[model samples]
Target: MTYIRTVLGDIEPADLGPTYAHEHLVIDGGRPVELYPDFDLSDVDRAVAELAPARDLGLACVVDAMPCSAGRNVRKLVEISRRSGVHVIAPSGLHLAKYYAADLWSERGSVDELAERFRADIEDGIDEHDYLGPVVERTEYLAGVMKIAGSEPSLTPRERRVYEAAASAHRTTGSPILTHCSEGLGALEQVRLLADHGVDPRHVTLSHTDKVIDRGYHREILATGAFVEYDQGFRWKAGVDNGTLTLLAWLFEDGYGDQLMLGMDAARQGYWTTYGGEPGMTFLLGEFAAAMRERGIGDDAQAALFVRNPARAYAFAPVAVTAG
Candidate 1:
């Protein structure tokens, strides 16, 4: 028997190849869009189209952090992966608490209940989609990681609940988690909480750290050996480039580039539509290379930033799947 072991249970880790560390297969605020009123791309169909470039670029996997009601497009995602020859990982925890509808949260009994839902997503499969609708069997749908996020200040109760559930899930099932922190405060606190609950900091990722640019915070978090994700490809309002340059330079100088991960975090239709610049991963990767080249960072450093570092942090073993 092929018994694959990880923080998240044992399974075949096939399908994931040349993966982007983060992405969204389908995200609908589910609100009426004032723009593109006639635009009708069902979540699955849209995911199929959005991923075309990744496939063409020889990207074999993408971890989609859509989570539960917000972007649990798993059925669609599986279909797309089968068609496009790409592996897609979906989130099974809470998104931003603000995105949590009050009626849903209030009606829910406690954080444990929410966690149970996540477990079901992982263990039982999302009910909205079945084989006919696009879902693979629950056993076939394995989440490589969980995901969570918080705001600028301290974490909210809802966010804390999500983290707690993530921690519990990690303990019970051994899945790692990726977090989104817009301002980067309380990341260390969250990391501590996860560690206290028995998760290794090495299995945690603090995303969007480039937004904060706090060197002290960066160093402290890295001390715990957690991965730092820099995902701001959008343009800046101040006419200055996002702090990626400064952050990268500092991390490189501090000898912490080995702990870094990169992504665009652009969940919109295109990269430039959300802001004003080139769109999608292709643009993001090119711009990052250009920026690094201008800064005299070596090609090996670039490969480490994109490849080796992420494999270490995320513990993705592409070879294991093929061997199986």
Candidate 2:
């Protein structure tokens, strides 16, 4: 059976029905939040409450993109999953360089060292301390996916190190790689870099690329066989030509639906209803899906974006990892 790992445990791919491929459920205080206050999502009770309606809307699983010290709380994720009965896949790799401090362990550590930590988080368990303080108590909850981010136009040196470490961990643990493409730029470079590191593009998802409205850019990136996740559907105003909808229709028309996925990427507090925000977590399933249907996107195509694509993109490859 092909099983996908989650914060709670592994489950069959079929159980990953109707997933938001990239999101942030809990973001405790950290450098990311310190830099941007709206990024804080620490209240477990609030998160659980906000997720209930979405769960009722058939949001079966969520891939939490917050990773490590950038406010990734494994314990909180576990509790949220258990209480909400919604599967959550936590990330184990790294975020943008700005999320970490200068002279941090991630900045100075070697690729192998970072890879070991990431593998331990995936194959073993996530650090209970969230890699914030020195004290680390490994918990039973595990990370299900690996994450890495790159800046626009080009990847900085530090980001390349993160990519290498994430690729190594993915190779070792058979974990899926989800990446941040700043403003949808540099996705081609991100795909090429991962390819250079011997990572299969099919197992790597490039997120936030929908922000770039250029169809040519998307066509080039999709040619690499990498999965593209669009999360800007809620940004475009109603009665306007939403670029997200326009692009999605173009991609689906081009017959690239299988390599596409959808998410909210609602990392800000202003986006959650529990935090008193509009376009709550259920907006996608409620309003956006209805709009897509009105725009001629059939149920089968919606199924591919919300369900089948995630199952295939996030599934652990069958290749076995060898021990030393």
Candidate topping TM-score: 2
CA lDDT, every model vs. true structure: 0.63, 0.90
Give the per-residue lDDT of model 2 (tens digit) for 1-324: 567999889999987899999999999988988999998899999989999999999999999999878899988999999999999999998888888888878888988989999999988789988776778788988898998899988999988998999888877778899999998889999989988998899999999998999999898899899999999999987688889888889999888989999999999999999989978899889999998998888899999999999999999876674776
Alpha-carbon lDDT of model 2: 0.90
For each predicted model, how many residue pairs clash, with residues at least 3 apart or on different chains?
Answer: 3, 0
| Every model's TM-score | 0.79, 0.97
Q: How does residue 199 of candidate 1 score in lDDT? A: 78
Off by over 4 Å in 2: 321-324
Q: Pick the candidate with the highest lDDT.
A: 2
RMSD of each: 5.9, 1.2
| lDDT tens digits, residue span 196-298, model 1 | 8777887888887777767888999899988888777454545785587778888889988788877767566545332233465565455566777788766
Error of 2 at 220 (Å): 1.3
User: Which stretches of candidate 1 lie above 4 Å from their native place?
Assistant: 1-17, 28-46, 105-107, 129-140, 237-242, 270-277, 316-324
Minimum summed lDDT over a 10-residue window in model 2 is located at 315-324
Give the lDDT of residue 231 in candidate 1: 76
